[model samples]
Target: MGNQQSIKIFLALMLSTAYIFSFSHFGALAYNTLFKNTDAFAAGTAIGHLDISEKTAAEAERLLEEEVEKWKAKTKITFSYKEKKAEADTALYEFYIEETLRTLKQGQKNLAAVDVDQEVLEEMIYRTSISLGTVEIDTKKLAADLLIGATMLDESGYTFHLENYIPEAVRKSETISKATVNAEGSLNEIKALLKKMGTVEIPAKAQFSFLRLVEEKDIQMHHSSALSIMGTAIYQAILPTNFSIIERYISNALPSYAKLGYEAKVDEKKQMDLVFSNLNDSAYSLQLSLKGNKLEAILKGQPFLNKYSIVKKDEQSFTPKTVKQYNARLESGETQVIESGKTGLLVKMVRKIFGESGELMKTEIISEDFYAPVHKVVVHSPVEPVQVTEQAETGAEEGEEEEQETPDSTTDENVPMPVPGAHSESEDGTEVDEEDNEGDEKGTEPQTSDNTGQGTDMPAGEEK
Candidate 1:
């Protein structure tokens, strides 16, 4: 019994020692993974506005060097609003791209330090703002955008709208696209509601929903016409931007306040909506203005690399059909024009994108719409009543006979906006599930951001 007890104590002591050793060894391994030796960045990680996920230290260094070289080649950023204009060259300021990559740590976020000449930019901003009758300038925000844009290696443009400087942050950035529609409406009740909506900001890779806006605003049902006109203006504004129109529809009849082939009809009860997604790498602001005889919708953001032109073409008109009617009191074989007919029409809307040097980059058809015409109906008295029998005459006298009616095969065919693999629904037709979550139709993907006020965290390494 004594020997057995001693053996049991020895086994227990060995098990405790093994347990402690194993715990210490694996704990150190876990610590290395979380803090020290893990060699890859977390997914969706960015280093100084540069996405360097899954990149080793060497790889990130190479990427940062390449970006710096590209930026050195194209680092000009222009600014303009209305008549005020200014230009900036980031290369002259020399943002710290090399310093950013030098401190890259294994498995961590690294934000780059961008150096911008704020004093000179402030002078330009002041001049531009004063010219526009504004005195305030947000030099920090402008500098940030400029720095980030510099790292992006593209020559873009921005606006000096004070709205973004205000406490409310109006969210107007660069002026990407704008469109104006000369329209006047009598919906006075909705003017206040519309005015309450000062300015709308669409975030990067976000969508603008018309019906959802109205519903959130708690607009009354009677203001649908005003909403539709507003929606039309928004659609027109988006037409010239890089933004993608997802679900736009036209009414069966054209609207009086909207331009032909440019109408976007929204019906809450019918579940029709006008939705567009901001497809760029930046956020955008949309402003609606109501002047004496003008209703304008302007989409403001960083200047798009290309310009867009909305064109209407290929208009084909069809002759209206004429039908005859028989009247007993009229003279035989006499035909009267009961109703004047109108011609049917179909139009194609195309969007043409042009380069900065005025060269055509691409041309895409937005939609094709066909409007039906009113048929011409005529009344006629025929002289072919000689074949009628006495029974038929008696039945006609007893009001039992019916008159023959004319046949019609005319139809209106409207083709909607085409999407990835198929076409969208026509006028007041079925719904296509194309909201373009990423604007992929235009090779656009949603840009993921950490939203860190600064570009990203600084990387760490042995060199640090």
Candidate 2:
């Protein structure tokens, strides 16, 4: 009898162990399933985190019914859910789902009329499901996890790759929006969604080119005989395009090429520095350092520029010598072959000033004939003194007599005066200015004059 009891006890222990193992396995599977189902529901129905009142939940359901009827829609399946309660450990919800379908003969009458297109049925199903909220998802962890996963997968998995490849294009393309999912059910339901997102091609054979330069003044100030750079770039697949060479040089360029990036400095030299990178089928970088009056260009970390061929082209004034002419091929009945004038801040001002007058000049070609005489400009500049003097004499100086009788006033030097052509620097050392000076010369300080206190010695045919 003791032996028998011992065997029974052993058997009981084995059964208990198996039961616990089985329960654990089931629990794990259920946990995973909850997330999977929520994901499917999210993809199929667009009912997202909803802050709905008891009244709104009912109203949404009613609205769905009305919308379905408006489409003259006949459905075999219809369902909805609502948030019964919001709880921390558990989420309570109520749901209702039903389907009715019938295959009717040409002459036979069917009670459950659901003979419809698959797409239409799918859409109706999705819309109806979207009307329900927390009624579908009860568990908090499951709901939260599914949302987090979907977001991660969508952003990292779906978008990251595309963005790395063709950033601008991919961002502009259409993707699976929440509203689209809610209305259409699934990604497959919307046939054109993926196609609309588009594709980017990376070419195997691509070439990248970049330009770099340093002024002669910079080289003289730094006391460097010459300037140079050296580096490397690679592409596994397609090449990069019009990259911001000046922007990404420090962060992306040097690291890609495995080169030591130095914070370049000029101790006694007055200089300018720039760095930028670009990638297309290939990657390219540009580094420019100016010292004294000399300029140098650096590629990677080695100099790849013709230092002897360095040129300084002023933006404010076009070089008539460098202007290239193309042979004009005239077409039959094509009489007008007007050449366009160069664009600049001053050009627009000329347009506005001339436009105000009845005799507007033809802006196609800007020559000496197109402008007013230089004396006219001088007249306008010295108008302030003449205007003030005339006003003082013409007006009945009532305030002047009262002030003379009572007291005197003094000028305040503390008042702020406008600093002409100056720019303010931000926290990051970026300069900001509102005046459009795209084609203006740099470092041209105002000069003192014989008569006037100070005036800019404007470049011939250029504006101040």
TM-score for candidate 2, please give it: 0.19
Model 2, range 286-391, lDDT digits (tens) per residue?
Answer: 3333323322233331111111111112224322111111112323222221222332111111111121123332322111111111110000110112124544
| Local distance difference test scores for all models | 0.60, 0.25
Q: Runs in model 1 with CA error above 4 Å? A: 1-185, 189-193, 329-338, 383-464
Which whole-number lDDT from 0 to 100 does residue 75 have in model 1? 51
C-alpha TM-scores of all predictions:
0.47, 0.19
